[model samples]
Target: MEQPFQFKQFLIHQDQCAMKIGTDGVLIGAWTSINENPVSILDIGAGTGVLSLMLAQRCMAEAIDALEIDDKAYEQCVRNFENSSWGDRLFCYHASLEEFADEIDDEYDLIISNPPFYSPSLVSTALQKGENSMSDARKKARFQDAMPFKHLIESVAKLLSKNGRFSVVVPFSEEEQFIKLASESNLFPLRILRVKGSPSSEIKRSLMEFTFSNSKIQSSELIIETTRHLYTEDYINLTKDFYLKM
Candidate 1:
């Protein structure tokens, strides 16, 4: 579990970061739209720098910035970026989204996040095993209070370029509320990808893309596996370029 995640073209060291590499970040990173060839990109709550690094591999974005609020995660993210093939173009900013939004004048042609989702009042089943097993920073990485959905959308609205697309991954149950929040900020959905763990499993997450202008919303579903450890064609096709085993 301590080993660096080896992508097809880059290596991510997540030892010090509270949040380790996971499917959610990888899904949004590989599924994010690159049709426009954005010149600049920003990743909010970039744990381990996986999403930013994925984009660095998929497109020639002149600059790719990642914002990580946790100090340990931020430092690890920076080290991961510097050790990557696109070191010069990648950067990690150690600041809250509100703080980062306050100081930056430039807008991102693309914005992304695999954000905090756990309810503040409810303890997660995994954490119940041993509440103290997880670090404080890791807890913040997954909890809404650290960066609530409202603030996340507002930050996206403020920093996203007029024509840019913002991509995010969240629990399926939160999709409508998340969209409503984004709509309030004038960011409308362009695409939605519902994701399931297996063909028979209920949808677990939504991979969404939004922009300032709207048209007909494109919608689809992605099943990650046919069975345990057996990848689906759609999932493998979506991430084959990045994941070595895919």
Candidate 2:
């Protein structure tokens, strides 16, 4: 049997989840701004409930809710939340963002997501290139068509409190487009962090923070490693709270 992923304060069993725990989820979970002392939080597309678990460890948020659309992933997310130290504060909802947004009237003080990155164009291109290693379940978990960016942003706009903040991680290529989509809902970017694998690698991801009010956009970059397996100091400092070996 595959062993559960052991963190400093929690264990995650990802066998039932299509999208296993990954660096993007960890980065967004650890990189998200929680200094506002948000009383309530919501984790969209919560695969293994890792992001919610991380926030529970980092903040005193009394209510931490997670939304998972897939059947197996939803069950596993609930299990993960129950297995965590903050079980009392964590809850998982098994529903798509659209359904949840339409049914729930409660607004969150903080909302975060590590959303699907592969758009239809990218998927088509990859398929043409014979990059067929991904499974069906993973395609649902990683493809934009499964949870469109427009749908995600619109739901987030409705689900966030007037003073709430939303954070997310997306492909660096999608940064401009994502920001534009968010702006349509009046959600403006407050900060952005572009991430690269190494000093010589092209930017691959973007960590973004958005709010209802307009403000000066703070931009920065993060290079994860100086070389293979050698994590950068900035990366270490950002994620040290959750990673066991950091």
Leading candidate by TM-score:
2
- Residue-level lDDT of model 2, residues 1-246, one tens digit each, is 777898888999999888888899999999899889999999999999999999999999999999999999999989988887899999999988989999999999999999888877688877877756888888898889899998999999999999999999999988899999999999999999999999999999999999999999999999999999999999999988878999
Q: Positional deviation of 44 in candidate 2, in angstroms? A: 0.6
RMSD for each of the candidates: 1.8, 1.0
Model 1, 1-246: lDDT tens digits are: 688889899998999887888899889999999999999999999989999999999999999999997888888999999898899999999998999999999999999999987755445654676764767777777777788899999999999999999999988988999999999999999999999999889999999999999778999999999989999899999999988988
In model 2, the Cα lDDT at residue 56 comes to 97
Q: How accurate locally, in lDDT, is each candidate?
A: 0.90, 0.93
TM-scores, in order shown?
A: 0.95, 0.97
Candidate 1, after superposition: displacement of residue 210 in Å?
0.6
**Deviation from native of the Cα of residue 21 in model 2, angstroms:** 1.1
Tell me how many clashing residue pairs each candidate has: 0, 0
